[model samples]
Target: MFPKTSLHTLFPTVNFTEITAIDMSVNSDFFREDPLHENLDLAREKITKFQNKYPMSLLANGYLEERAFYNTPNFERTLHGVKEYRNIHLGTDFWLPESTAVHVPFDGTIVIAHDNNYHKDYGPLLVLKHETETAPFYTLYGHLSKESLVISPKGKNVKQGELLAYLGSEEENGHWVSHLHFQFITDLLNETENYNGVAFPSEIEKWKKLCPNPSVLFEEEF
Candidate 1:
């Protein structure tokens, strides 16, 4: 369950007023031209160009935005004997450079610190279990570098704003551009190492309850 009060005061939150917000949704100008359809290199180039436009500013994509970036077989799924695609993102992505520092947003215990070594996988993933008064929930950090595992190992206790990890390179981060795939999970559905970061558009309402928007913790209104 989510916290009753806003988590913004818990730590210094990012105001999008300072950080630039990039539209990676299907309606965005870049993706509207033509689908990349598994051409991650071109997608990275476009994303890099957007970030370079506003030098030194962090670029972010908000939660629940439907994106076409996951065009590979990795995002395909079967439902009711029919094929469906998982394109609706469940978290907010902060596009950053490789090795960019990522910090914890809350105090929690490291439940998972493992590398999922498959293509389009969360190369270095960390899941932290945060206990609230209502119930225990989890936060997931994906696309982190190898050094993160060494810094925050499983079962380790971490504090708010502590250095959690660094953004992994495209080679290490599921072959996508460097970014932090941050998500909030009310339940892991018995998962350990990783959790579904995207869902089928048809079942979005169901997944939304399981995974709330990570932006609720941000001071900047979404």
Candidate 2:
């Protein structure tokens, strides 16, 4: 079970309604309806173009959206001799400028802060563990600035509304557009440095239960 109240905003003093909601999923009107066929840089350029279109407003992508952009080999997995593709995103993304400060939404202890520096990977990922009346749950912040590691290392206690990390640049944040991939995890599945931010469409039901929609924190449906 999760708490229903007293959560803070990840960003300070920003109006959530003012933020623009964009569909970056497969068959999206914003991006191509089909899977993109290009290199990482080219794919990133497409995101940049969308960002440029909404320069003044914050952009968001909904959780559980099926994205065709993750067509790269990096998203492939060999499971039991069968190839599995993880394209259904499990987290909500906030597209913002580089160096944007990210704050803690609830009182928690930093459980993990590691740099997963592979191409199109989640760079400088941070996981915070929060204790509730029933049990403890975890929150993950991905594509964060490297300085986030020094500021909020593992085993550190953080308060709500406290600065947790800043957004990272493209060169450092997995070579993608600057954005925060925020997710909620009821269980880590024994993962340490990284957690699955996306899942196969067939196994989406399981992942949806493990990583519940984070929109409750924002108090809006993206």
Error of 1 at 145 (Å): 0.4
Q: Which stretches of candidate 1 lie above 4 Å from their native place? A: 1-17, 32-34, 37-41
lDDT of 1 by residue, 36-121 (tens): 42566777788888866877565767589888766657788877898877889898788767887777777899998999877777
* True-structure lDDT of candidate 1: 0.78
lDDT of 2 at 62: 64
C-alpha local distance difference test of each model: 0.78, 0.81
Could you list the CA RMSD of all candidates, in the order they appear? Answer: 3.2, 3.1
Against the hidden reference, what TM-scores do the models get? 0.85, 0.85
